[model samples]
Target: MALAQYARLGVISRSAPGLVLARPLLAAVPRSTTTSVLRSLASSARAGRFASSRREPGMVPVGRRTRELPVNTIIKFVPQQEAWVVERMGKFDRILEPGLAFLVPVLDQVKYVQSLKEVAIEIPTQSAITQDNVTLELDGVLYYRVVDPYKASYGVENAEFSVAQLAQTTMRAEIGQMTLDRTLAERNQLNINIVESINTAAHDWGIRCLRYEIRDIHPPENVVQAMHSQVSAERSKRAQILESEGARQAAINVAEGHKQATILASEAVKTERINEALGAAEAILAHARATAQGIEKVAASISDSPNGHDAVSLTVAEKYVDAFGNLAKQGTTVIVPTDVNNVGSMVAQALAVYKNIGQARETPTALPKDSRKQAILDTLVPQQDTPPARK
Candidate 1:
């Protein structure tokens, strides 16, 4: 009986152990390939975790290795300058092709924008006195360009602002030392000199001085007014001088005309006087010739009167009578040539000559009664003897 109970208890124990063993075998039989696949999956998951832990943020993962990637690895390079920012999210989306990319960290980021293309500066207008003690104003412009990008970026805190300030200070110092007159007189040359001076120093600051211009200058109002007045006065003086000179020339012309007229009048008078004198002389010569001719003819005809007393008396009486007759015809006043005392003597002489001629012509008369005595006396007398009878 003891042995049977023991066998029975042993069988129960065996049955429980067999149940445990059968349940495990049944589960193992259904999941054999699945278990192998699960094992491979777990191993793959472990490897992926390991890869993820080893990768850098901006690195491109390439199977167990990481590469410092270019900006174009996942996005197009939108060209960023140093110290500038760029948003490339959409660009990266277009470039990435189910792949990986790397990029420089933010601390090493490059800039992407440029600076201003041009810069201008104005120098302060300066007041100065010229060598002539004249006050003047000087104003100028400064032009500059960035030569070194790196120096422009790092040399000055603000390149434009710093260069402008430097230029102002430098120009002020230079202009103040110059006289106002010099600044005004040599504006262009001063600009070039200033530009050269500024450029010489600006080269170290990565600035290049380009062309410079002088804008405007203002002088004292009085100086300008004085210059204008001086010009006007000069013009007025010149006009006055010209007018005076013209008047003088006119006076000279008048004098010359008067002189010519006087000379012509004097010459005319001289010619007239000479002609009158010549005419008088010719008349005197012709009258003398006629008188001589009359004298010669009278002398030739008086042959019987050689002593010439009767001829002279006759000629004188004839001339006197002709003069009286001519004076009566022309009604001219006359001064007779014969004296009253000589007139009777001249007439008696003429009568005596006539009687002598008559007596000579008479013949001895025949007796005439007159008685016969009177006839004889009458015959003895000349035929021209009328005066003896009257006595």
Candidate 2:
């Protein structure tokens, strides 16, 4: 029975050969009391074995480990980008850097571990009110790093949480200072302001705020709709203005073109009229020149030929008869001279007029004006015979 009890308490295994128990002590205890004690011890041993088995590998129970490091380890290897704050006898001592480090067992303990590398913290979506009284939901990301391990470990209970809260408050404050339009438009500047504000407060916590970026901003649905409408209306207004300007320019151009065309047409007409007048003048001058040349030739012929005068007299007689015939044919009534049949007399009158004109031409200043006129008239008029008593 004692041997079984010992095996049940795990002091010895039943399968082990040659296992022994103290008979005197087992005998001295009362049988009932001995069974109860063995049962309690067996239960405790089972519990301890089960708990030890359940614990994670390489992990010490809480309060038994120094800052997650294995207890009683003299040599520790610190990872890169990490800082381990050490405490010696419950007081601040020194920090352990990356790589291999030694610690006096039982005397030195790692109190806190800080990450030297940058960390990203999410700023949860929170309501913010703009200067224009518009409410917005804003969320962002914050990038930071631990600069001083000692301060990060001692200055603040939780560096990341504190920085995150500061960032949110600062973002809200900045948004409150700006109008809705500015908040939406100048997101980058808003982020920068938030980073600056966070760094200022987080300096004691040994955290440097590198940058802040707004992930999203959501305005009310009505505001979004209104903004859309405003943009559409503005675009329409610009389109109308551009169209009107284009139309006005087109009209101006058309008017200018018409004016130019009219001017050009008028100029062309003026040129045509001038050309026609010049042609007519030239024609009239040419005719006058031809007439003067013919007259000179005729004068030369009359002076050079001895029969010229007779030929002229005969030509004048033929023309005078032809003139009378033409006048009779032109109309039923004709004005005839009393001596119309006397062709010889008309020829004599014409020759006399021709002679006077020849003499005037020979000496243009020889005859006075009155004498030349009277001479031509006397030659043209025939002498009248005495008329019978007025019929």
Please list the C-alpha lDDT of all candidates, in the order they appear: 0.51, 0.73
Candidates in order, TM-scores: namely 0.34, 0.59
Q: Which stretches of candidate 2 lie over 4 Å from their true place?
A: 1-72, 256-260, 298-391
- Name the best candidate (by TM-score): 2
Tell how far residue 9 is off in model 2, in angstroms. 22
The TM-score that candidate 1 achieves is 0.34
Error of 2 at 211 (Å): 1.9
lDDT string for model 1 (89-207, tens) is: 31221121222333332212222222323456676787655556677665667777665544554465555566666666665565666776467567777777767877777676666
